[model samples]
Target: MKVFLTSLFLACFLLIIAPPLMAVVDLYEFDTESQRQRYHALIEVLRCPKCQNQNLAGSDSPVAEDLRRELHQMLLEGKTDREIKTFMVDRYGEFVLYKPRFQKSTVVLWGLPLVLLVLGLGIVAYIVRGRQSTNTRKMSLDELSSSEQDQLKSLLKTSSEETETPP
Candidate 1:
């Protein structure tokens, strides 16, 4: 019974700790601190083609691993950041870039948010103006003409008389 309890405790501890230990960690050596920093930054901003929205730094897919290796190789070859990005774009297309450049091809991607925001603001303003006009019309006692006021008074009197009588 003592041995079984000890084994159970050990198994529970391993289960709790194993996930962190099993996490994918890339260990690439860089010639300089700048290179290491640049590599880390590039990986963070580059998306994994296989994982859709996941960045290379966070993705554990085989494609991400392969991309990491390719990036490391490029860095070792002393490729400029722009050159590295261009190469990746050429090979994997713009989808691999987390933030694509503003070009004719990507104008919609960059401009869509601003256009939608302006459209939304215009719609809200129109709705607010409509509501304000309606509220003003409803709330203003002086807006009622003499004839309308007289008709309103007669209606109120009739309603009051009807309400005062038992059904």
Candidate 2:
């Protein structure tokens, strides 16, 4: 029991400490602190092409590593942020950027949610209007033909009489 407890404790300790050590460390050298900060910020925002949902900094895919290296090289070459973004966009399309630029191509991506919301509201309004119209158009007993009203009254009288008299 003591040996088992020791092994469990050791396993727990390793599990707690291992994740921080397993994180990717970008080792590229930057000439200034600002450059390093810029690189870090860019990697955190840039989406990994291969991982789809993960940012370049958090992804372990080969494509993420390549993009990181390219970004580092661009920074070292003194390329402006816009120039680097344009380069990545030219190569990988707007999907590479986490915050995609507002352009003709991306209007659908930005506008789709609003459009869907409007459509949903329209459908709800239509259903509500249909229900209201149906309720308003309901036929009253007074509006029924004299023969139909007499037949309904006779049916109700027979049903009530049958219920009042036990079999």
Q: For model 1, how does the per-residue alpha-carbon lDDT over 1-167 read when each residue is reduced to its tens digit? A: 99999999999999999999999788999999999999999999999999969999989999999999999999999999999999999999999998999999999999999999999999999999999989877745477898998998899999999999998
Model 1 misplacement above 4 A: 8-24, 135-148
Error of 1 at 83 (Å): 1.2
Error of model 2, residue 28, in angstroms: 5.4
Total clashes, candidate 2? 0
Q: How well does candidate 2 match the true structure in TM-score terms?
A: 0.64
Residue-level lDDT for 58 in candidate 1 = 89
Model 2, poorest ten-residue lDDT window?
Answer: 20-29
Top candidate (TM-score) = 1
List TM-scores for all candidates, in order.
0.78, 0.64
